[model samples]
Target: MKQRNILISGLSLVLMTSVSSVAMAQCTATGTAAGFAPQYAPFAVGGALNTLVSSINAANTAFLTQSTAFVGSPANPKPDQEGGGIWARGIGGEINTKNTVSSTYALGGNGSTFQPVATPLTGGVNCNTTTNLQFAGTQVGTDMARLNWNGWNVHMGSMAGYLGARARDTTAATPGINAGGSLSNSLEVPFVGAYAAATYGSFFIDGQIRWDFYQNTINDPIQNGLFNQKIDARGLAFTANAGYNFQLGNNWFIEPSAGIVISQVKVDPLRATGTLLLTGAGSIPNTTTFSNIESYLARLSVRVGTTIVSDKMIWQPFVTASVYHDFAGAAKAAYSESNNPAFEALSFPLIQGNLTANNLGTYGQFALGIAGQVAGTGWLGYLRADYRTGDRIEGYSLNGGLRYQFTPDML
Candidate 1:
């Protein structure tokens, strides 16, 4: 009976020990699955939970700091976690992509003329004649442009523009007692141009090209006869420029630029008479034919300016000075001739003389303007005036235009 009791007790002890071992194994497996140390599973799990909370807190703090920096506020408490920094990245700069169109008209009059004469003389009967003349000319022009990107900040854009001129003289006349006659001349010139420019860090570069066309007509009547003349001319010009801006206090800035303009021109002249056409002639006889001429010219310019900006508006005022070199081309002739017999019989005297190579002169000009954005929108506008003085011509010009922004990426 003592041996039976001892065996039973031993079996009970083994069963209890096996159950405890299984429970310990299960705990070790769970610890490994949860990525914790097996000997200190509970403590390791608690430490990991605390670490995760700390990581989340740090992230929240960083986000708050960035948010505060964006709103021009450094010490403000965290509000709703909203994205506000994107719009502040380029706040002080301006970008323009719209087009601007403008037109201008001008008129001026000032000219002089002189005449030489020949007469017949006989013994005790002599006749002599001499004449001098004065006249005035009216000048008119139209100027237009497609775009202008002028702002306080960086920008990229393109422009297309044109300028045209017309001049006429009504008081010009020919001389002689029996030479009851009248003479007049008219001229028209047109130009078209296009350009592109980009700006970065107070610096900008631009390139442009232009084409010009000119037409001229002259009418003169002498001794009951009529004369007509026509001339056609064409020109091409190009410019490349680089500029820098200096910022001054009080909403002011100054920009100076240097540029080179190259131009080429060609001219053709023709003349005819009407009296010869009536005498068995369908074509009016030609009295003179002037040789065609070509010219190459160079020019330079500089500009200075400033700008002011508010929430919904911007304003800029600028001034520019420019000069051009003498032209290099064929010389104008004082007189020309033809073999038509009717021209020889009437002996029509020389009319207006031609411009010589030495007569080609240099010119300079000054211009001022203002450009800015409209209130409450991205629209742009400008007003400008200019005065030009030179050896060849002098005049004043005025222009204005507006543009509307069509794309966000353009600004």
Candidate 2:
């Protein structure tokens, strides 16, 4: 009887302990669910627990989808046994993509050779001149700049301030004179310029200005009478431009621009001889000086092309038309000198003359070229080559440069 009672008591005790353990386990699970819900989803309570759970799961999936689009990575925190994961990482202060800054610098030489129809003289006098001559030379130098913060699907910056030299020489041969007169002219011009632009979506607008100081000399004599004449010229020009760039498909874009250039030019011509034979030698000695100025210019341009292989490499072929209004002071001076008392008595014929006047009308220019990136941390470095033609001027220019990015972020 005693053994039976002991076994029964022990079994009762074991039963009670098992029941207590089950109850404790259930309480612990409920507590864990409550804690997670209150902290992560405070408003997701009441009888809508199932709906809340579904909504939370959808939001988590959406966040992961968006995050992976930028930096291929998995969502933080492991999923629970029920297959729903809680977002353990905070979305605060996180960047989806890193901003990029690019800078570039390039150097190159440009040259060209051409022959145009010569201007024919009417009376066919033995004036002795040449036609259909060829001329060519190169411009050597480097350009530099910088580009930055191009991440917002837009690009904006000022690519300006490049310094370089353009040296050109032309030679023409003419027969009929005692000795075939060969005329050679050379010019050296230094230029400094700047440009600014902004791009949004498929459209871009830009403007630029450049200043050139020119010095040129021509060594030619008409029938060995004029000797060699040297011209010292100085000028300042400002160009204002506005353009729109249109994107065509992938890697192709076309930009058409219109602008005006106002230029101030001064040309001083020095004669090789001083004495005026008609005025009796002593009246006029040697060295005659003539000066003139040109002040207004306007232009329009259209560029079409695309990038090669990469977004950093661009090739744009363009055509431009420009016109200038000649200033009058120089022309008036030349006329005065021709009708002077000494010149009239000596009967010295006027040879070549230039003057400033408003009657000068429109001129045209056509250019074709390619510009692209070379080497650098930014897109500021560029290499460009172009051929341009207009009234009294036709030639090819090559430009390359390096740019350093200073303030990429500007209001």
Candidate 3:
């Protein structure tokens, strides 16, 4: 009887152990569902690229339209030299940032074994961005640093203040992001920059250099399904232009210009450094690095205008047409999460993903502008209606500004 009782107890204990092992077989993924979200990789990266390019282009356009068409060309009568001065300008506009985003994401690592089920992320996204820039500062002339030499005229303006740029996903029920609404992004970086233009004889040149930040913001950090922290990026961008001034007659003139832009941008990795609980025996590492982004843009423009002089005021009116193209290819982002050398990446439902964005090829623009100056006050003002004529990225802006020359007579 004793021997039989020992055998029964041993078998019962073995059976209990088996049941416990089977009960804990499921490897639960811990941390916020966002920690495991593979769908957002493309949406964030692609949206960010679109925003960066659009912002750069917006700054370029603002710089181009801020001034009048009356360059110091031999075709028109030369006005007396006006000393250094101050200027204040404001610009508010909107542009269409269309992107073709595609991604590959993994799901269903719930089984007891290591496996990844990749889901196609081909649902397109449409984001129209609203942009605002304010500029106010001193301009250099012959009186300041000999900035003007021979017949050359140069003035520098600074754009340093709070800038607003917002891009929201307007699509209907963007899949894999929420249960009811789409994911929206906002750029919180403050914009700052400077622009310079010089005119010598029948030749002219203008350019601008500005700092570009690539951070992205969403309305809700936590999605109904999953979400993560905001992404951060930073870079530098600059635009250069050159042109020659010619005349059709004493009152009419023609101007042709060429411009180019070059920039270097970098995107920060997601969950750069952190470890999440695996709910079983190990931890999940969160980290990903995007490829380097280097881009170049080129454009051409032509302007025709006439100068009108009257007793009370002088007016310069012109119309401009231009075509531009971006030479950058799409950015391909690589994703990885297994940082622990000892930890097995394929053990659970670990994710492997990739994302990319299409580049906007060629765009056109049309603008109408008028500049005027008071006969005796030495005060100059300009107003321009600028429009993007391309179907892919069409938009418009009404920009205006006031400038004053600080001369001895004024004092």
Against the reference, the lDDT scores of all candidates come to 0.31, 0.27, 0.46
The candidate, 2 or 3, that scores higher on TM-score is: 3
- Please give, for residues 1-411, the per-residue lDDT of candidate 3 as tens digits: 222111111111000000000000011122233333423233332333333334434433333333222222112213544445555555556555444444454533433234333432122222222222222222222212123355555555555433345544332233443222234445555446676666665566666676656565534233211143577666666777777757677777677877777766676765532223312322245455666565676778887776677776767777878787778876566555553434444444444556665554677777788766665553666666777644345566666666555542432
Candidate 3 segments whose C-alpha is farther than 4 A from its true place: 1-82, 105-148, 154-159, 172-181, 191-196, 213-216, 220-231, 271-288, 337-348, 408-411
TM-score of 3: 0.65
- Tell how far residue 268 is off in model 1, in angstroms: 3.1
lDDT value for model 2: 0.27
lDDT of 2 by residue, 1-411 (tens): 222111111111000000000000001112212222211111111111111111111111111111100000011112220111111111111101001111111111111111112321111011111111122212222222122224111122222121212111111122211122233334444544444343332333434444555455444333212333445555555544445555576555555655554545555644443323432332122223333343443445555555553333323333333332323221222211232444434433222211221212333433333433322222222333433322322333333333332221210
The root-mean-square deviation over C-alpha atoms between each candidate and the true structure, in angstroms, is 40.4, 37.1, 22.9
lDDT, candidate 1, residue 366?
70
Model 3 C-alpha lDDT versus the unseen true structure: 0.46
Which 10 consecutive positions of candidate 1 have the poorest summed lDDT?
A: 15-24
Pick the lDDT winner: 3
